[model samples]
Target: MQSKLLAPYEIREMTFKNRVVMSPMCMYAVEKKDGIVTDFHFTHYGSRAVGQVGLIMLEATAVLPEGRISEQDLGIWSDDQIAGLKKLVAHLHKSGAKVGIQLAHAGRKAQVPGPIYSATKLAFSEKYQTPEALTIPQIETVVSAFQKAVKRAEAAGFDVIEIHAAHGYLVNQFLSPLVNRREDQYGGPIGNRYQFLNEIIEAVRSEWTKPLFVRISAEDYAQEGVHLEDYLMMSRWLRDQGVDLIDVSTGGVIPLEAYDVYPGYQVQYADRIRKKVGIATGAVGMITTGNQAEEILRNERADLVFIGRELLRDPYWVKTSAKLLNAEDQLEVPTPYQRGWR
Candidate 1:
């Protein structure tokens, strides 16, 4: 049977060749403090493109220097980084894959030397740094940083731009009541907590006309944390803000908690948000096989399947999946690999 996983998906003007997406997984390969793309990034992403992954979402690239999760993470904060990013995008395009970059800020989670910043002056753990709470003006500056990063992404020729609002990052910090303890308009109610993300989206829209995505940690896993219902409201707000899709992920608001985890564990969150909010969503986490990916799409659980660790283990996962599902012809095998496929 033909694989639904191999079907084409279109968001905005860009058409993904298949439903399989390489979820952004950071490779701490940058060799300089400048956070430019190195040969490792080119080779890493290039191999996935060559293996026929439909959309390659590059890892969490910081929008500001201090926002980096680590010193080795990629950055889009400078004009000098554009050329290297453009080169990577160009190669991925040549190999028949759409490309995206996850624009992010680690917030209090940043392990770098400088002052860490968060919505509240809270540290993720005893070992983590106590972040300086952003003043109102400082918050605006962060929003501006996102705007500038969008401009850089446009200049770098990315097909899609995903805002990293999930995984206990900067935006997630503001969204969760467990951390955002501000009395200002930026805190208190859920609507107020959403203010930071709302402003960033608006600012990004000003400079970006292409397809935009936001990765949100839908379920914070704590009793006081944001839940699936909260994410439904968040997804609705995102759709209204001109977001093309929501990459659904869960947890990471606080220190890790014990939860039942298995294959396609997060697919339920994607299904719920997509149905309730009436917006496209992507399912990620523990989704390893082509059949599992196909099942999600066939049932209309999500618009796309984001494969992470599986792809890290095997860059040619898409191709191998095509063969497993007897849909080998759906993916274009390189001339050199034609013999193996035959």
Candidate 2:
């Protein structure tokens, strides 16, 4: 009656209560000028923690002001934002769930009326200007920004810090052939494309003493985008550099024109990457069932499965899923709701 997915697991100095983690979904709630964490963020994340998730990952929190996905995306550009974030982290930790922040940079996707990206000079079908390519000095600044964010995240009491290196954001753009047309050290070969992520990982690790996660797309899901072979190579490099988990998600390079994305379609990539890199991983995308999740864990396909939209739809989905699979003892929901348990 018990499912392994509802069981506890350990990764890099911390033990999660179970395998259920809240995926970082953008709320776009932060205002333009102020980068402070609002009460809205506290409530949004705290509720899920109270609902008994194993880990709670905050949305793509920008490392710099211009790196925001949109003007509303959270940022840790200044030390001032730490206090507000601490208040929320305290709530999650007190509720017996661990918390992490997905540190990100939108890169070429910066500055939009909304969250958007255009890496190359050629837009999909519209006229657009190419972004002012980041100079070596600017790149260094960003690396420092990541380090500063990690320091703040630790100060705010996060249990883990995941570098948002995938999904066609800044780091992904540098790695994708479709976006990066640079003739410099950051572009060209797979090694150079991987250099940026490695540098960020090295810098972030210096300040972060906890588990460091790097989320990556197994494939850009485009024949022309980053291929699986190169993705695997990059993932291996990350493992060598000391990443705790390779959170696997795909298809943010351009768009998927011919992807066969059934439920749990991306799980195979997590399986492949883990076997190849010999590193722990978190599987995501279209994973909705407890049975399916347990199968991923049972087969050793992934170390963890992050539930996104499903968690949004049902905050207490974990308890319901545990019982449906007859694994109720695996998790402890609020005692006040004890009568509701079957």
Candidate 3:
């Protein structure tokens, strides 16, 4: 049965069936009204639940209306949306998977007319318009939105709550000097720049009792964005503040080759963040094989691994991966479905 050590583990009060996680991917099927998730969300997340991944982080859900990446993005700013998200958590739990929600704000990335949003703006191009910078009150509102959303997630029965501080989103924007040129308290050197994230984490930490996770861009890939060294400094602070894990994923801070990135091109960030922070880390990006995943775990580079596009390609990738890892017997089959794998 492969190493049982890799089978199930616990942090805070939630236990996952394995180290593999379903990295959040947008279905772009969401239908929201004044910032709320609709029936489509339940069906979409519910199906992912049945796929048997150890942990599932919902996509980048906006915390406010103006913060939304697009018209169809899921949101968590109201009670109606909370009800639907709760239903998702219940369904996923019954399906035998722990659930997580990724709370995000698109910052200058907001209000894109399509299903996807990007950080900063393309004002220099004839095709795009630069966004209005958020005011102090607006920043405070976003902070509350995240706190409220996280509380809603707990009420909705989510086992984990991952703060989306990566991908050049709101928090990412603040962390990056390139995008955030504000002269106020939220900009400047590392300490001042991290104020936004620190406040959000502190607020969420005060209100949330679950295993708090943070997804971060180890390097913004540009000299102006948050560099790897800054992450080392910031990650230590995150650990001190009671963050359980750092979801180490890169890019989205600056545009780079998305399709051409080689396997584990970004894994180095994961390794460094883990060592620098001394916290449990989740390595994600270009990871595609059982041995590769196993090697990461064996070398202690990361405590967990998240598989994105790969899982979308094979819902039962876990079963196949177990076979490749020679741990087939650990498969937790439902009695009715045992015969298939047998």
Cα lDDT of all candidates, in order? 0.94, 0.83, 0.78
User: What is the TM-score of each predicted model, taking all chains together?
Assistant: 0.99, 0.94, 0.92
Error of 3 at 268 (Å): 1.2
The TM-score that candidate 2 achieves is: 0.94
- Cα displacement (angstroms), candidate 2, residue 119, comes to 7.0
| RMSD values, in order shown | 0.8, 2.2, 2.8
In model 2, the worst 10-residue window by lDDT is: 120-129
Model 3 alpha-carbon drift over 4 Å, by segment = 4-6, 32-43, 112-126, 257-260
- Our tally of clashes for model 2 stands at 0
Mark the 10 consecutive residues where model 3 has the least summed lDDT: 116-125
Q: How far is candidate 2 from the true structure (C-alpha RMSD, Å)?
A: 2.2
Please tell me which predicted candidate would have the highest lDDT against the true structure.
1
Per-residue lDDT of candidate 1, residues 113-140 (tens digit): 8898999999999999999999999999
lDDT of 1 at 141: 92
Mark the regions of model 2 whose C-alpha exceeds 4 Å error after superposition.
31-33, 113-129, 256-258
TM-score of candidate 3 relative to the true fold:
0.92
